[model samples]
Target: MYYIGIDLGTSAVKLLLVDEEGSITSTVSKSYAVEYPRPGWSQQNPADWWEAVTAGARELMAGVDTAQVRAIGTGGQMHGLVALDAAGEVIRPCILWNDGRTEEEVCFLNETIGRERLSGLAGNIAFAGFTAPKLLWMRKHEPDNFARIAHIMLPKDYLTFRLTGEFATDYSDASGTLLLDVEHRCWSAEMLEICGVSEAQMPRLMDGAEAVGTLSAAAAQELGLPAGTVVAAGAGDNAAAAVGCGAVAAGSCNISLGTSGTIFIPSDGFRVDAHNALHSFDYVEGRYHLMGCILSAASCSGWFVGDVLKAEDFDAEEAASDPAVATVDLPYFLPYLMGERSPHNDTAARGAFVGMRADTSRAQMVRAVREGVAFAIRDCVEVARGEDIRIERSTLCGGGSKSALMRQTLANVLNIELDLPETEQGPGYGAAMLAMVAAGDAPSVEACVGRIVRMRGSVVPDPQAVAAYEERYQIWRQMYPALKPIYRQMAR
Candidate 1:
């Protein structure tokens, strides 16, 4: 039998076909544009996402036995707000997760509403990228659209609804919405009231592994799948990626380097830090995890190399930096191109290059871009360490992980062994595994992950490199606080 997994990402939709043995049989991707009508705003048409998923699914299942396909699951970008009208039509472009237009709303939540109360209610504080801030932004600036919101869902849940005719979302995805009472696994009544939304506007919440419904006949026909194929309530990208990397066990960690970066550590109990710097969310495996998200990661590298440098060969550009000079004099890049989340939570934060010399080469700047991202991830690791979460090792996956330089830099900077998974499909693969559980092809999430996920190799930290990075990280850490005032001024 076969299962289909969909990864509804920021820039593209990726579909995977996996057999009962957990091997990927086919993959298809379809790209779409992200609209930016104004600075700090990011949006996408829901119609664009649905069009891409259906097209990608048809291509993925080409020449495969249709009868063998048993289930469908999805792992999607989290926190995006997809508002729907009474007739089930999209009200407007979805406010994407990376959009920084919620600064005012975030400040209102964190300051006016009080972070302590927000954390107590939602198990997290408001950030510009979360779904609650977006809702508040809409109610304040686009009141008409807000009034028409008969239903609200995340990006992947919208796809799931289209597939199964079920308005439901998994806890892993809902946890990022700031509307969920994450500790108790329900929608927070106070939060809903604060956002001027009712519980009726929310989708039904389910565990990530639960079967929401079967595919609708129209959806099955459009995607070339069977009508009765099971559809699992999927997870947020980070949680699903953790499952893909087999990081479901207590204290096991996974670091992702996709469009956004995250350090995900799954735990069996629910716990929140004193400052609420890390997100406390329900994991795909039905427990809890702490995750720190950086708004820019691989995309920073992409922007530097492609847009700033106008270069096509990323490998060649990355390969040009001198290792010796890199450790000593290279400028520190902030890696905050699209503002930031996690410990800082500053939407006004802007990317900058500090300590640059007159003779600084482009190669060194390129190296700084990579090092900057590594340093940003280290910021998260340090927070986890504050809570006594010792991450001696972690599974690594995503587009940036394919770079040998990035892998070694991350290992040394983090001072942790980074494991490479044999099947590095991340969310797409984990989504497939969720489908298996829903179909009874696997006994449980843990059992399926244990049987299928395998490590390909490891990248151990170099002691000397670790020492150098530690010194550099200390200097880099001081830059953010010093620049915070300037960022706010620039925003004004």
Candidate 2:
């Protein structure tokens, strides 16, 4: 049998076809535009997402036997607030996960409502990207639209609803909304009241691998797939990526360097960090995981190379760099281009280049961008360490992981072994694995992951590079705290 995995990303929807054996057969991607109507605000139309997925599915299944397809699952960008009216039409363009227009709402939740109360109810503190803050923003700013919110869902759950005619969400995705009582695995009544939302607005919750419903006849005809194909309750992008890397077992770790970066550590039991630096969310495999997310990762380098330097070839740039100079006299870069999450949940924080000299070379700047991302990831590692979760080694995946320089830098910076997966499809592959379980081709999410996910190789930390990064990271840590006052002033 064949299964389809859809990764509904920030900029595109990637669909992958996998056979019963877990080998990927074909893949297709459909791109959509993200709108920045105002500075620090991001939005996307739900109609565009449905249109892309349908078109991409047709392309993915081209010349293939659609009758052989048994199930479909998705891993999507999480925390975006997609609201629907009574008639099931999208009330407005989704407030995207990276949108930072919720500063007032976040402050209201954290300072006014109190972080301890919010954390006790939702297992997390308010961040600008979370759905609760977005909801509050809408209520205060767009009251008419807020009043029409009959149903609320995340980005991927909207796709699942379109396919199965079911309003359902996986625990992994729901946990990020700052609405779920994550420790209890349910929606918090207190949080619902605080957000001025009712429980009825929420979607039915399920484990990521559990089948929510089958494809509707209309959806099946539209996509050229068999009717009644099971649709699983898919996960948030990070949790899905973790499953793809076989990071479901307790103490297992996975680091992703996509547009955003994360340090994910799966746990057998629920555990919240004292500082609430790491997100405590339900895992796709019916366990729990702590995740620390940085707002930008590979995008930092992308910005430096593409936007700043106007260069397209990253590998060539790295190849041409002076290896001797690359290792010494490097400037520090604070990669808070979209503000920061995890460790420091400061939305006012902005990116900056500190300790730059007049003679700073492009290669040195490039190295700084890469190393800066590594250091930001190390910040999360440090937080997890504070919680006594020792993440000595982790599986790494995503667009940034493709760079050898990044892989080596990350390994040395964190002083941890980095394992590269044979198939770095990340969320797409993980969604496919969830589909396998939903279709009964696999027993459980963990077993399916164990059978399929393979590590290609590991990057062991070099002693010399590790020592050098240790010193640099200490200096890098001080940069953020020193700039906190400036960031607040700049925001005002």
- Best candidate (score: lDDT): 1
Which window of 10 residues has the lowest lDDT sum in candidate 1? 321-330
lDDT of 2: 0.91
Displacement of residue 187 (Cα, Å) in model 2 is 0.6
lDDT string, candidate 2, 366-466, tens digits: 88888889999999999989877788899999999999989998999999999999888999999999999998899998889878888899999988878
Q: Give candidate 2 misplaced runs (Cα > 4 Å).
A: 322-328
Residue 477 Cα positional deviation in candidate 1, in Å, after optimal superposition: 0.6
Residue 146, model 2, lDDT: 99
Query: Which residue pairs does candidate 2 place in steric collision?
Result: none
Report the error of model 1 at residue 487, Å: 0.8
Candidate 2, run of 10 with poorest lDDT = 319-328
